[model samples]
Target: MALIGIARLASESELLEAKSRVTYFEIAARRILNRTKPNMPFQWTINPYRGCEFGCKYCYARYTHEYMELDVQDFEDKIYAKPAAADRVRLELRRIDRKDHIAIGTATDPYQPAERRFGRTRSILEAFARERGRHLGITTKSDLIVRDLELLREIARANVLSINITITTLDEKLARLMEPRAPRPALRLKAVRQLAQAGLVVGVFPNPIMPLLTDSERALDRLARRARDAGAQYFGAGPLFLMPCAQKVLLPWLEDNFPALALDYRKLFEHSAYLGSGAKRILRARVEKIRDRYGLNSGPLEYRPELWLGEEQASFELRD
Candidate 1:
Protein backbone atom coordinates (compact mmCIF):
# COMPACT_ATOMS: atom_id res chain seq x y z
CA MET A 1 0.00 0.00 0.00
CA ALA A 2 1.02 3.59 -0.47
CA LEU A 3 2.26 5.54 2.56
CA ILE A 4 -0.92 7.63 2.72
CA GLY A 5 -3.09 4.53 2.42
CA ILE A 6 -1.14 2.92 5.25
CA ALA A 7 -1.61 6.02 7.39
CA ARG A 8 -5.36 6.04 6.71
CA LEU A 9 -5.68 2.40 7.69
CA ALA A 10 -3.73 2.98 10.87
CA SER A 11 -6.00 5.88 11.82
CA GLU A 12 -9.19 3.98 11.08
CA SER A 13 -8.16 0.85 12.98
CA GLU A 14 -8.11 2.78 16.24
CA LEU A 15 -11.85 3.48 15.96
CA LEU A 16 -12.58 -0.26 16.19
CA GLU A 17 -10.41 -0.77 19.27
CA ALA A 18 -12.30 -0.18 22.50
CA LYS A 19 -9.26 0.26 24.75
CA SER A 20 -6.67 3.01 25.04
CA ARG A 21 -6.60 6.54 23.60
CA VAL A 22 -3.50 5.79 21.51
CA THR A 23 -3.07 3.20 18.81
CA TYR A 24 0.08 1.48 17.56
CA PHE A 25 0.79 0.35 14.00
CA GLU A 26 3.71 -1.66 12.71
CA ILE A 27 5.12 -0.56 9.37
CA ALA A 28 8.06 -1.56 7.24
CA ALA A 29 10.35 1.47 6.95
CA ARG A 30 12.45 1.66 3.81
CA ARG A 31 15.16 3.63 5.63
CA ILE A 32 15.76 4.51 9.24
CA LEU A 33 18.79 6.78 9.17
CA ASN A 34 17.95 10.29 7.97
CA ARG A 35 20.32 12.99 6.84
CA THR A 36 19.86 16.21 8.72
CA LYS A 37 19.23 19.46 6.86
CA PRO A 38 22.27 21.49 5.96
CA ASN A 39 23.67 23.65 8.80
CA MET A 40 22.29 21.30 11.49
CA PRO A 41 24.83 20.36 14.14
CA PHE A 42 24.40 16.63 13.50
CA GLN A 43 24.76 15.05 10.10
CA TRP A 44 22.34 12.14 10.61
CA THR A 45 19.39 11.18 12.83
CA ILE A 46 17.35 8.05 13.64
CA ASN A 47 13.73 8.08 14.75
CA PRO A 48 12.71 4.48 15.54
CA TYR A 49 9.11 5.52 15.75
CA ARG A 50 6.89 7.97 13.92
CA GLY A 51 4.55 10.11 16.04
CA CYS A 52 4.97 10.68 19.78
CA GLU A 53 2.54 9.84 22.58
CA PHE A 54 3.72 12.36 25.16
CA GLY A 55 1.55 14.97 23.39
CA CYS A 56 3.40 18.06 24.45
CA LYS A 57 1.27 21.06 23.51
CA TYR A 58 4.15 22.88 21.88
CA CYS A 59 5.45 19.95 19.85
CA TYR A 60 6.95 21.18 16.56
CA ALA A 61 7.04 17.77 14.91
CA ARG A 62 3.29 17.74 14.29
CA TYR A 63 4.07 18.49 10.67
CA THR A 64 5.41 14.98 10.27
CA HIS A 65 1.91 13.53 10.06
CA GLU A 66 1.11 15.88 7.23
CA TYR A 67 3.49 13.97 4.97
CA MET A 68 1.28 10.92 5.44
CA GLU A 69 -1.86 12.99 4.69
CA LEU A 70 -2.95 12.56 8.28
CA ASP A 71 -4.35 15.22 10.54
CA VAL A 72 -1.98 17.02 12.88
CA GLN A 73 -3.80 15.44 15.81
CA ASP A 74 -2.83 12.04 14.42
CA PHE A 75 0.74 12.86 15.27
CA GLU A 76 -0.01 11.97 18.87
CA ASP A 77 -2.90 9.54 18.58
CA LYS A 78 -1.49 7.18 15.94
CA ILE A 79 2.02 5.86 16.56
CA TYR A 80 3.93 3.96 13.91
CA ALA A 81 6.68 1.59 14.99
CA LYS A 82 9.26 0.66 12.39
CA PRO A 83 10.03 -3.04 12.01
CA ALA A 84 13.59 -4.26 11.41
CA ALA A 85 14.84 -0.84 12.48
CA ALA A 86 18.00 -2.29 14.00
CA ASP A 87 18.94 -4.26 10.89
CA ARG A 88 18.35 -1.28 8.67
CA VAL A 89 20.39 0.95 10.99
CA ARG A 90 23.30 -1.46 10.88
CA LEU A 91 23.31 -1.41 7.09
CA GLU A 92 22.87 2.39 6.92
CA LEU A 93 25.79 2.96 9.27
CA ARG A 94 28.09 1.40 6.71
CA ARG A 95 27.37 4.38 4.46
CA ILE A 96 28.00 6.89 7.24
CA ASP A 97 31.63 7.75 7.96
CA ARG A 98 32.85 7.36 11.54
CA LYS A 99 33.25 11.12 11.95
CA ASP A 100 29.60 11.90 11.18
CA HIS A 101 27.29 12.15 14.18
CA ILE A 102 24.10 10.07 14.38
CA ALA A 103 21.46 11.54 16.69
CA ILE A 104 18.53 9.43 17.84
CA GLY A 105 15.02 10.73 18.59
CA THR A 106 15.48 13.89 16.61
CA ALA A 107 11.83 13.78 15.55
CA THR A 108 10.09 11.32 17.87
CA ASP A 109 10.92 10.24 21.41
CA PRO A 110 12.65 6.92 20.87
CA TYR A 111 11.97 5.94 24.50
CA GLN A 112 8.35 7.03 24.59
CA PRO A 113 5.77 4.73 26.18
CA ALA A 114 5.51 2.74 22.95
CA GLU A 115 9.09 1.63 23.50
CA ARG A 116 7.97 -0.56 26.40
CA ARG A 117 6.17 -2.80 23.93
CA PHE A 118 8.12 -2.21 20.71
CA GLY A 119 11.74 -2.16 22.01
CA ARG A 120 12.91 -0.67 18.71
CA THR A 121 15.04 1.90 20.49
CA ARG A 122 16.70 -0.77 22.58
CA SER A 123 17.31 -2.88 19.49
CA ILE A 124 18.91 0.10 17.74
CA LEU A 125 21.18 0.64 20.71
CA GLU A 126 22.15 -3.02 20.53
CA ALA A 127 23.17 -2.45 16.93
CA PHE A 128 25.19 0.60 17.90
CA ALA A 129 26.96 -1.38 20.66
CA ARG A 130 28.62 -3.52 18.02
CA GLU A 131 30.12 -0.52 16.24
CA ARG A 132 33.27 1.38 17.20
CA GLY A 133 34.38 5.01 17.05
CA ARG A 134 31.04 6.50 15.98
CA HIS A 135 29.47 9.66 17.36
CA LEU A 136 26.06 8.93 18.82
CA GLY A 137 23.52 11.05 20.68
CA ILE A 138 20.06 10.29 22.03
CA THR A 139 17.56 12.84 23.26
CA THR A 140 14.34 12.09 25.11
CA LYS A 141 12.14 13.18 28.01
CA SER A 142 11.25 9.65 29.17
CA ASP A 143 13.04 7.95 32.05
CA LEU A 144 12.57 4.65 30.20
CA ILE A 145 16.06 5.14 28.77
CA VAL A 146 17.51 3.83 32.04
CA ARG A 147 16.15 0.41 31.14
CA ASP A 148 18.99 0.01 28.65
CA LEU A 149 21.77 1.50 30.74
CA GLU A 150 24.04 -1.47 30.20
CA LEU A 151 23.56 -1.33 26.45
CA LEU A 152 24.25 2.41 26.47
CA ARG A 153 27.38 1.89 28.51
CA GLU A 154 28.62 -0.71 26.08
CA ILE A 155 28.08 1.67 23.18
CA ALA A 156 29.79 4.48 25.09
CA ARG A 157 32.86 2.34 25.67
CA ALA A 158 33.61 2.31 21.96
CA ASN A 159 31.70 5.28 20.56
CA VAL A 160 31.26 8.86 21.75
CA LEU A 161 27.76 8.88 23.26
CA SER A 162 25.87 11.83 24.71
CA ILE A 163 22.41 11.51 26.22
CA ASN A 164 20.23 14.62 26.42
CA ILE A 165 17.30 14.66 28.80
CA THR A 166 14.87 17.47 27.95
CA ILE A 167 13.39 19.23 30.99
CA THR A 168 11.43 22.34 30.08
CA THR A 169 10.58 23.50 33.57
CA LEU A 170 11.15 22.62 37.21
CA ASP A 171 7.61 23.70 38.11
CA GLU A 172 5.60 20.51 38.17
CA LYS A 173 2.28 22.29 37.69
CA LEU A 174 3.55 24.29 34.77
CA ALA A 175 5.08 21.18 33.25
CA ARG A 176 1.81 19.30 33.54
CA LEU A 177 0.02 22.10 31.79
CA MET A 178 2.52 22.28 28.96
CA GLU A 179 3.61 18.69 28.52
CA PRO A 180 0.50 16.89 29.76
CA ARG A 181 1.39 13.27 29.06
CA ALA A 182 5.15 13.39 29.34
CA PRO A 183 6.94 12.07 32.38
CA ARG A 184 6.92 14.65 35.18
CA PRO A 185 9.75 17.11 35.71
CA ALA A 186 10.90 15.36 38.88
CA LEU A 187 11.09 12.01 37.11
CA ARG A 188 13.12 13.56 34.30
CA LEU A 189 15.51 15.12 36.79
CA LYS A 190 15.92 11.78 38.50
CA ALA A 191 16.67 10.23 35.13
CA VAL A 192 19.40 12.82 34.53
CA ARG A 193 21.01 12.02 37.87
CA GLN A 194 20.83 8.31 37.21
CA LEU A 195 22.27 8.59 33.71
CA ALA A 196 25.14 10.72 34.99
CA GLN A 197 25.73 8.38 37.92
CA ALA A 198 26.07 5.55 35.44
CA GLY A 199 29.13 7.44 34.07
CA LEU A 200 27.30 8.60 30.96
CA VAL A 201 27.60 12.15 29.74
CA VAL A 202 24.14 13.64 30.28
CA GLY A 203 22.82 17.12 29.50
CA VAL A 204 19.55 18.94 30.19
CA PHE A 205 17.73 20.74 27.40
CA PRO A 206 15.00 23.33 28.05
CA ASN A 207 14.00 23.61 24.44
CA PRO A 208 11.03 25.52 23.01
CA ILE A 209 11.29 27.79 26.01
CA MET A 210 7.78 29.24 25.98
CA PRO A 211 7.59 32.98 26.23
CA LEU A 212 6.06 34.51 29.38
CA LEU A 213 5.97 30.97 30.73
CA THR A 214 9.45 29.46 30.88
CA ASP A 215 11.49 32.38 29.53
CA SER A 216 11.87 34.42 32.67
CA GLU A 217 15.39 34.70 34.09
CA ARG A 218 14.17 33.25 37.36
CA ALA A 219 12.49 30.31 35.64
CA LEU A 220 15.49 29.45 33.50
CA ASP A 221 17.88 29.95 36.43
CA ARG A 222 15.87 27.69 38.70
CA LEU A 223 15.71 24.97 36.03
CA ALA A 224 19.44 25.25 35.37
CA ARG A 225 20.28 25.04 39.07
CA ARG A 226 18.10 21.97 39.53
CA ALA A 227 19.65 20.33 36.51
CA ARG A 228 23.12 21.09 37.86
CA ASP A 229 22.18 19.65 41.24
CA ALA A 230 21.05 16.53 39.42
CA GLY A 231 24.62 16.13 38.03
CA ALA A 232 23.82 17.32 34.53
CA GLN A 233 27.00 18.25 32.63
CA TYR A 234 25.35 20.89 30.42
CA PHE A 235 22.23 23.03 30.04
CA GLY A 236 20.88 24.38 26.75
CA ALA A 237 17.70 26.19 25.77
CA GLY A 238 16.00 27.70 22.73
CA PRO A 239 12.99 29.93 22.42
CA LEU A 240 9.78 28.28 21.23
CA PHE A 241 9.16 27.90 17.50
CA LEU A 242 5.50 27.53 16.63
CA MET A 243 5.01 26.36 13.10
CA PRO A 244 1.44 26.54 11.75
CA CYS A 245 0.71 22.96 12.77
CA ALA A 246 1.96 23.54 16.31
CA GLN A 247 0.12 26.86 16.61
CA LYS A 248 -3.14 25.13 15.79
CA VAL A 249 -2.88 23.14 19.02
CA LEU A 250 -0.73 25.38 21.19
CA LEU A 251 -2.69 28.59 20.54
CA PRO A 252 -6.01 27.24 21.78
CA TRP A 253 -4.39 25.73 24.86
CA LEU A 254 -2.71 29.06 25.51
CA GLU A 255 -5.94 31.03 25.13
CA ASP A 256 -7.68 28.76 27.62
CA ASN A 257 -4.89 28.76 30.17
CA PHE A 258 -3.04 31.97 29.45
CA PRO A 259 -5.46 34.35 27.81
CA ALA A 260 -3.14 37.31 28.14
CA LEU A 261 -0.26 35.53 26.43
CA ALA A 262 -2.32 34.13 23.60
CA LEU A 263 -2.57 37.41 21.74
CA ASP A 264 1.11 38.07 22.24
CA TYR A 265 1.96 34.65 20.87
CA ARG A 266 -0.13 35.14 17.77
CA LYS A 267 1.53 38.49 17.21
CA LEU A 268 4.99 37.14 17.82
CA PHE A 269 4.61 34.10 15.62
CA GLU A 270 2.27 35.67 13.11
CA HIS A 271 4.83 35.90 10.37
CA SER A 272 7.19 33.08 11.17
CA ALA A 273 7.78 30.16 13.49
CA TYR A 274 11.04 31.53 14.86
CA LEU A 275 11.10 34.12 17.56
CA GLY A 276 12.55 37.49 16.68
CA SER A 277 16.32 37.91 16.97
CA GLY A 278 15.88 40.31 19.87
CA ALA A 279 13.83 37.78 21.80
CA LYS A 280 16.24 34.96 21.02
CA ARG A 281 19.25 37.00 22.16
CA ILE A 282 17.61 37.82 25.47
CA LEU A 283 16.79 34.17 26.18
CA ARG A 284 20.22 33.01 25.07
CA ALA A 285 21.99 35.49 27.33
CA ARG A 286 19.79 34.55 30.27
CA VAL A 287 20.39 30.82 29.75
CA GLU A 288 24.14 31.33 29.25
CA LYS A 289 24.48 33.22 32.52
CA ILE A 290 22.59 30.53 34.39
CA ARG A 291 24.63 27.79 32.71
CA ASP A 292 27.85 29.55 33.71
CA ARG A 293 26.72 30.09 37.29
CA TYR A 294 25.83 26.41 37.58
CA GLY A 295 29.20 25.43 36.06
CA LEU A 296 27.49 23.66 33.18
CA ASN A 297 28.55 23.73 29.57
CA SER A 298 26.45 25.52 26.97
CA GLY A 299 25.58 22.25 25.19
CA PRO A 300 26.45 18.58 25.00
CA LEU A 301 30.17 18.04 24.64
CA GLU A 302 31.47 16.03 21.68
CA TYR A 303 34.37 13.63 21.89
CA ARG A 304 36.47 11.98 19.20
CA PRO A 305 37.18 8.37 20.04
CA GLU A 306 40.84 7.37 19.53
CA LEU A 307 39.95 4.89 16.79
CA TRP A 308 38.24 7.56 14.71
CA LEU A 309 41.07 10.06 15.08
CA GLY A 310 43.23 8.03 12.70
CA GLU A 311 40.54 8.13 10.05
CA GLU A 312 39.93 11.82 10.63
CA GLN A 313 43.66 12.53 10.32
CA ALA A 314 43.87 10.55 7.09
CA SER A 315 40.95 12.51 5.58
CA PHE A 316 42.57 15.80 6.65
CA GLU A 317 45.92 14.81 5.16
CA LEU A 318 44.21 13.86 1.90
CA ARG A 319 42.56 17.28 1.78
CA ASP A 320 45.87 18.99 2.61
Candidate 2:
Protein backbone atom coordinates (compact mmCIF):
# COMPACT_ATOMS: atom_id res chain seq x y z
CA MET A 1 0.00 0.00 0.00
CA ALA A 2 1.12 3.55 -0.77
CA LEU A 3 0.28 6.78 1.05
CA ILE A 4 0.53 10.39 -0.12
CA GLY A 5 0.11 12.51 3.01
CA ILE A 6 -1.71 10.92 6.01
CA ALA A 7 -4.19 8.90 3.87
CA ARG A 8 -3.65 5.19 4.43
CA LEU A 9 -3.59 3.13 1.27
CA ALA A 10 -5.31 -0.27 1.36
CA SER A 11 -3.11 -3.36 1.64
CA GLU A 12 -3.85 -6.96 0.72
CA SER A 13 -4.62 -7.96 4.28
CA GLU A 14 -7.34 -10.33 5.42
CA LEU A 15 -8.67 -8.26 8.32
CA LEU A 16 -9.32 -4.54 8.98
CA GLU A 17 -9.02 -3.22 12.53
CA ALA A 18 -10.06 0.45 12.28
CA LYS A 19 -9.76 3.80 10.43
CA SER A 20 -9.73 7.60 10.94
CA ARG A 21 -12.03 10.51 10.01
CA VAL A 22 -9.58 12.43 7.85
CA THR A 23 -11.19 12.87 4.42
CA TYR A 24 -9.31 12.53 1.12
CA PHE A 25 -9.81 13.96 -2.37
CA GLU A 26 -9.24 12.10 -5.63
CA ILE A 27 -10.63 12.29 -9.16
CA ALA A 28 -12.24 9.23 -10.74
CA ALA A 29 -10.69 8.57 -14.14
CA ARG A 30 -13.60 6.62 -15.60
CA ARG A 31 -13.49 6.02 -19.35
CA ILE A 32 -16.26 3.73 -20.61
CA LEU A 33 -19.94 4.22 -19.87
CA ASN A 34 -22.36 1.34 -20.53
CA ARG A 35 -21.06 -2.14 -19.83
CA THR A 36 -22.48 -5.60 -20.66
CA LYS A 37 -21.73 -8.99 -19.18
CA PRO A 38 -23.34 -12.37 -18.68
CA ASN A 39 -24.05 -11.49 -15.03
CA MET A 40 -25.69 -8.08 -15.23
CA PRO A 41 -28.08 -6.46 -17.67
CA PHE A 42 -26.42 -3.02 -17.50
CA GLN A 43 -22.74 -2.54 -18.31
CA TRP A 44 -21.73 1.04 -17.34
CA THR A 45 -21.51 2.19 -13.71
CA ILE A 46 -20.32 5.09 -11.48
CA ASN A 47 -19.80 4.92 -7.74
CA PRO A 48 -19.85 8.40 -6.12
CA TYR A 49 -18.87 7.41 -2.59
CA ARG A 50 -16.21 4.82 -1.78
CA GLY A 51 -16.56 3.80 1.91
CA CYS A 52 -20.22 3.45 2.75
CA GLU A 53 -21.58 4.79 6.04
CA PHE A 54 -24.31 2.14 6.13
CA GLY A 55 -21.87 -0.44 7.46
CA CYS A 56 -23.88 -3.44 6.32
CA LYS A 57 -22.61 -6.51 8.18
CA TYR A 58 -22.26 -8.51 4.97
CA CYS A 59 -21.11 -5.62 2.83
CA TYR A 60 -18.62 -6.83 0.22
CA ALA A 61 -17.68 -3.24 -0.62
CA ARG A 62 -15.74 -3.23 2.66
CA TYR A 63 -12.76 -4.30 0.54
CA THR A 64 -12.91 -0.88 -1.09
CA HIS A 65 -12.10 0.65 2.29
CA GLU A 66 -8.81 -1.25 2.25
CA TYR A 67 -7.76 0.79 -0.75
CA MET A 68 -7.86 3.83 1.56
CA GLU A 69 -5.60 2.14 4.10
CA LEU A 70 -8.53 1.01 6.16
CA ASP A 71 -10.17 -2.34 6.89
CA VAL A 72 -13.71 -3.49 6.10
CA GLN A 73 -14.91 -3.20 9.70
CA ASP A 74 -14.07 0.52 9.85
CA PHE A 75 -15.60 1.21 6.44
CA GLU A 76 -19.01 2.11 7.82
CA ASP A 77 -18.15 4.44 10.75
CA LYS A 78 -15.39 6.33 8.81
CA ILE A 79 -16.08 7.94 5.42
CA TYR A 80 -14.27 9.76 2.58
CA ALA A 81 -16.30 12.11 0.36
CA LYS A 82 -14.99 12.91 -3.08
CA PRO A 83 -13.60 16.42 -3.61
CA ALA A 84 -14.89 18.87 -6.28
CA ALA A 85 -17.14 15.99 -7.36
CA ALA A 86 -19.68 18.11 -9.23
CA ASP A 87 -17.04 19.92 -11.21
CA ARG A 88 -15.26 16.63 -11.80
CA VAL A 89 -18.50 15.21 -13.13
CA ARG A 90 -18.80 18.13 -15.50
CA LEU A 91 -15.25 17.57 -16.67
CA GLU A 92 -15.85 13.86 -17.14
CA LEU A 93 -19.15 14.46 -18.90
CA ARG A 94 -17.65 17.00 -21.26
CA ARG A 95 -15.18 14.36 -22.38
CA ILE A 96 -17.73 11.66 -23.12
CA ASP A 97 -20.83 11.53 -25.30
CA ARG A 98 -23.84 12.18 -23.02
CA LYS A 99 -25.88 9.41 -24.62
CA ASP A 100 -24.46 6.48 -22.69
CA HIS A 101 -25.98 4.55 -19.77
CA ILE A 102 -24.65 5.06 -16.23
CA ALA A 103 -25.36 3.38 -12.90
CA ILE A 104 -24.62 5.02 -9.52
CA GLY A 105 -24.10 3.52 -6.07
CA THR A 106 -23.15 0.21 -7.59
CA ALA A 107 -20.38 -0.24 -5.03
CA THR A 108 -21.57 2.03 -2.21
CA ASP A 109 -24.74 3.75 -1.11
CA PRO A 110 -24.53 7.25 -2.63
CA TYR A 111 -27.09 8.77 -0.23
CA GLN A 112 -25.53 7.34 2.89
CA PRO A 113 -25.63 9.46 6.07
CA ALA A 114 -22.58 11.51 4.99
CA GLU A 115 -24.44 12.53 1.85
CA ARG A 116 -26.58 14.91 3.92
CA ARG A 117 -23.40 16.94 4.23
CA PHE A 118 -21.45 16.23 1.00
CA GLY A 119 -24.37 16.19 -1.47
CA ARG A 120 -21.96 15.20 -4.26
CA THR A 121 -24.23 12.42 -5.50
CA ARG A 122 -27.14 14.84 -5.61
CA SER A 123 -25.05 17.32 -7.58
CA ILE A 124 -24.05 14.67 -10.11
CA LEU A 125 -27.71 13.76 -10.52
CA GLU A 126 -28.47 17.40 -11.19
CA ALA A 127 -25.88 17.34 -13.96
CA PHE A 128 -27.44 14.23 -15.49
CA ALA A 129 -30.92 15.72 -15.31
CA ARG A 130 -29.96 18.23 -18.00
CA GLU A 131 -28.50 15.54 -20.24
CA ARG A 132 -30.65 14.16 -23.08
CA GLY A 133 -30.83 10.68 -24.53
CA ARG A 134 -28.89 9.48 -21.49
CA HIS A 135 -29.66 6.44 -19.35
CA LEU A 136 -28.99 6.23 -15.60
CA GLY A 137 -29.66 3.86 -12.69
CA ILE A 138 -29.57 4.57 -8.96
CA THR A 139 -29.42 1.94 -6.21
CA THR A 140 -29.91 3.23 -2.68
CA LYS A 141 -31.49 2.53 0.69
CA SER A 142 -31.99 6.20 1.65
CA ASP A 143 -35.10 8.30 1.44
CA LEU A 144 -32.99 11.40 0.78
CA ILE A 145 -33.67 10.56 -2.83
CA VAL A 146 -37.14 11.99 -2.31
CA ARG A 147 -35.41 15.38 -2.12
CA ASP A 148 -34.55 15.08 -5.81
CA LEU A 149 -37.92 13.92 -7.03
CA GLU A 150 -38.38 16.93 -9.29
CA LEU A 151 -34.95 16.54 -10.86
CA LEU A 152 -35.33 12.77 -11.24
CA ARG A 153 -38.73 13.22 -12.82
CA GLU A 154 -37.23 15.64 -15.28
CA ILE A 155 -34.47 13.21 -16.13
CA ALA A 156 -36.90 10.32 -16.60
CA ARG A 157 -38.93 12.41 -18.99
CA ALA A 158 -35.98 12.76 -21.35
CA ASN A 159 -33.78 9.79 -20.55
CA VAL A 160 -33.84 6.53 -18.62
CA LEU A 161 -33.88 6.65 -14.80
CA SER A 162 -34.43 3.48 -12.82
CA ILE A 163 -34.13 3.77 -9.06
CA ASN A 164 -33.52 0.48 -7.24
CA ILE A 165 -34.38 0.54 -3.55
CA THR A 166 -32.37 -2.27 -1.96
CA ILE A 167 -34.16 -4.11 0.86
CA THR A 168 -32.37 -7.31 1.84
CA THR A 169 -35.01 -8.34 4.36
CA LEU A 170 -38.41 -6.99 5.26
CA ASP A 171 -37.83 -7.68 8.95
CA GLU A 172 -36.91 -4.28 10.36
CA LYS A 173 -35.06 -5.87 13.29
CA LEU A 174 -32.92 -7.86 10.90
CA ALA A 175 -32.56 -4.71 8.83
CA ARG A 176 -31.23 -2.81 11.84
CA LEU A 177 -28.58 -5.44 12.47
CA MET A 178 -27.56 -5.84 8.82
CA GLU A 179 -27.54 -2.12 8.04
CA PRO A 180 -27.00 -0.31 11.33
CA ARG A 181 -26.30 3.13 9.87
CA ALA A 182 -28.55 3.01 6.84
CA PRO A 183 -31.97 4.57 6.64
CA ARG A 184 -34.88 2.61 8.08
CA PRO A 185 -36.48 0.09 5.78
CA ALA A 186 -39.84 1.81 6.07
CA LEU A 187 -38.42 5.13 4.92
CA ARG A 188 -36.71 3.45 2.01
CA LEU A 189 -40.05 1.92 1.02
CA LYS A 190 -41.56 5.36 1.31
CA ALA A 191 -38.93 6.70 -1.03
CA VAL A 192 -40.00 4.09 -3.52
CA ARG A 193 -43.60 5.13 -3.07
CA GLN A 194 -42.82 8.80 -3.60
CA LEU A 195 -40.65 8.15 -6.64
CA ALA A 196 -43.25 5.94 -8.23
CA GLN A 197 -45.93 8.54 -7.54
CA ALA A 198 -43.77 11.01 -9.45
CA GLY A 199 -43.92 8.71 -12.50
CA LEU A 200 -40.38 7.33 -12.32
CA VAL A 201 -39.82 3.64 -12.92
CA VAL A 202 -38.83 2.25 -9.54
CA GLY A 203 -37.60 -1.22 -8.50
CA VAL A 204 -36.45 -3.21 -5.49
CA PHE A 205 -33.25 -5.23 -5.15
CA PRO A 206 -33.50 -7.92 -2.42
CA ASN A 207 -29.94 -8.75 -3.22
CA PRO A 208 -26.94 -10.88 -2.47
CA ILE A 209 -29.82 -13.00 -1.39
CA MET A 210 -28.19 -14.18 1.82
CA PRO A 211 -28.93 -17.90 1.96
CA LEU A 212 -30.77 -19.08 5.09
CA LEU A 213 -30.32 -15.51 6.28
CA THR A 214 -32.73 -13.15 4.53
CA ASP A 215 -33.58 -15.75 1.90
CA SER A 216 -36.79 -16.93 3.55
CA GLU A 217 -39.03 -17.65 0.60
CA ARG A 218 -41.94 -15.97 2.39
CA ALA A 219 -39.86 -13.01 3.50
CA LEU A 220 -38.53 -12.41 -0.01
CA ASP A 221 -42.02 -12.82 -1.40
CA ARG A 222 -43.34 -10.19 0.99
CA LEU A 223 -40.60 -7.74 -0.02
CA ALA A 224 -41.41 -8.23 -3.66
CA ARG A 225 -45.07 -7.58 -2.97
CA ARG A 226 -44.31 -4.44 -1.00
CA ALA A 227 -42.27 -3.00 -3.86
CA ARG A 228 -44.94 -3.94 -6.35
CA ASP A 229 -47.54 -2.19 -4.20
CA ALA A 230 -45.32 0.88 -4.22
CA GLY A 231 -45.49 0.73 -8.02
CA ALA A 232 -42.03 -0.69 -8.56
CA GLN A 233 -41.45 -1.96 -12.07
CA TYR A 234 -39.73 -5.17 -10.83
CA PHE A 235 -37.55 -6.77 -8.21
CA GLY A 236 -34.11 -8.40 -8.67
CA ALA A 237 -32.33 -10.76 -6.27
CA GLY A 238 -29.43 -13.22 -5.93
CA PRO A 239 -27.05 -14.77 -3.32
CA LEU A 240 -24.30 -13.68 -1.00
CA PHE A 241 -20.72 -12.96 -2.19
CA LEU A 242 -18.28 -12.70 0.69
CA MET A 243 -14.98 -10.81 0.65
CA PRO A 244 -12.08 -11.40 3.05
CA CYS A 245 -12.17 -8.04 4.87
CA ALA A 246 -15.96 -8.12 5.11
CA GLN A 247 -15.78 -11.59 6.61
CA LYS A 248 -13.76 -10.15 9.48
CA VAL A 249 -16.85 -8.43 10.86
CA LEU A 250 -19.71 -10.20 9.13
CA LEU A 251 -18.73 -13.76 9.99
CA PRO A 252 -18.57 -12.90 13.67
CA TRP A 253 -21.96 -11.28 13.50
CA LEU A 254 -23.31 -14.40 11.87
CA GLU A 255 -21.82 -16.67 14.51
CA ASP A 256 -23.22 -14.56 17.33
CA ASN A 257 -26.69 -13.86 16.01
CA PHE A 258 -27.62 -16.52 13.47
CA PRO A 259 -25.53 -19.38 14.72
CA ALA A 260 -27.85 -21.84 13.07
CA LEU A 261 -27.02 -20.57 9.60
CA ALA A 262 -23.28 -20.12 10.12
CA LEU A 263 -22.32 -23.63 9.05
CA ASP A 264 -24.61 -23.43 6.05
CA TYR A 265 -22.89 -20.22 4.96
CA ARG A 266 -19.52 -21.93 5.26
CA LYS A 267 -20.69 -24.73 3.07
CA LEU A 268 -21.96 -22.20 0.55
CA PHE A 269 -18.82 -20.02 0.29
CA GLU A 270 -15.86 -21.21 2.40
CA HIS A 271 -14.31 -23.43 -0.24
CA SER A 272 -15.06 -21.30 -3.32
CA ALA A 273 -16.51 -17.96 -4.44
CA TYR A 274 -19.91 -19.39 -5.43
CA LEU A 275 -22.35 -21.80 -3.76
CA GLY A 276 -21.76 -24.36 -6.47
CA SER A 277 -23.51 -24.25 -9.83
CA GLY A 278 -26.31 -26.54 -8.69
CA ALA A 279 -27.03 -24.52 -5.55
CA LYS A 280 -27.18 -21.25 -7.46
CA ARG A 281 -29.45 -22.85 -10.05
CA ILE A 282 -31.81 -23.99 -7.33
CA LEU A 283 -31.78 -20.60 -5.61
CA ARG A 284 -32.29 -18.76 -8.89
CA ALA A 285 -35.17 -21.07 -9.63
CA ARG A 286 -36.65 -20.36 -6.21
CA VAL A 287 -36.25 -16.61 -6.78
CA GLU A 288 -37.95 -17.01 -10.11
CA LYS A 289 -40.92 -18.58 -8.39
CA ILE A 290 -41.09 -15.89 -5.71
CA ARG A 291 -40.85 -13.13 -8.28
CA ASP A 292 -43.45 -14.84 -10.37
CA ARG A 293 -45.82 -15.08 -7.42
CA TYR A 294 -45.27 -11.46 -6.35
CA GLY A 295 -44.60 -9.97 -9.76
CA LEU A 296 -41.09 -8.69 -8.73
CA ASN A 297 -39.49 -9.55 -12.03
CA SER A 298 -36.53 -7.32 -12.86
CA GLY A 299 -33.06 -8.36 -14.15
CA PRO A 300 -29.65 -9.69 -12.85
CA LEU A 301 -25.80 -9.44 -13.14
CA GLU A 302 -23.01 -11.42 -14.89
CA TYR A 303 -20.09 -13.56 -13.66
CA ARG A 304 -17.80 -14.93 -16.33
CA PRO A 305 -14.25 -16.32 -16.20
CA GLU A 306 -13.06 -13.92 -18.90
CA LEU A 307 -14.15 -10.86 -16.92
CA TRP A 308 -14.31 -12.01 -13.30
CA LEU A 309 -12.27 -15.10 -12.50
CA GLY A 310 -12.59 -15.54 -8.72
CA GLU A 311 -12.68 -12.11 -7.11
CA GLU A 312 -14.69 -10.68 -9.99
CA GLN A 313 -17.41 -13.27 -9.47
CA ALA A 314 -17.55 -12.23 -5.82
CA SER A 315 -18.52 -8.72 -6.95
CA PHE A 316 -21.09 -10.11 -9.36
CA GLU A 317 -23.38 -10.88 -6.39
CA LEU A 318 -22.76 -7.25 -5.37
CA ARG A 319 -24.71 -7.27 -2.08
CA ASP A 320 -21.72 -5.00 -1.75
Model 1 bad stretches (over 4 Å): 1-19, 301-320
Regions more than 4 Å wrong, model 2:
1-40, 84-87, 97-99, 300-320
- lDDT per residue for candidate 2 within 1-320, as digits (tens), equals 34532233222222322336434333232321224354544555666655777888877777666655565666775565544355566666666655555677766788886677667788887777777777688888899989889989888888878888888887889889988877888898889899989998888888767777777778877888888888887887767777677668877898999998777777677876555788778878877897788666554332221232122112221111
Candidate 2 displacement at residue 19 in angstroms: 13
Predicted candidate 1 versus true structure: per-residue lDDT over 83-109, tens digit per residue? 645666788789999998888886789
RMSD of each: 7.7, 6.1
Cα-based lDDT at residue 220, candidate 1: 87
Best by TM-score: 1
Lowest-sum lDDT 10-residue window in model 2: 311-320
- Indicate the residue-level lDDT of 271 in model 2: 76
Clashing pairs in 1: none
Tell me how many residue pairs clash in candidate 1.
0
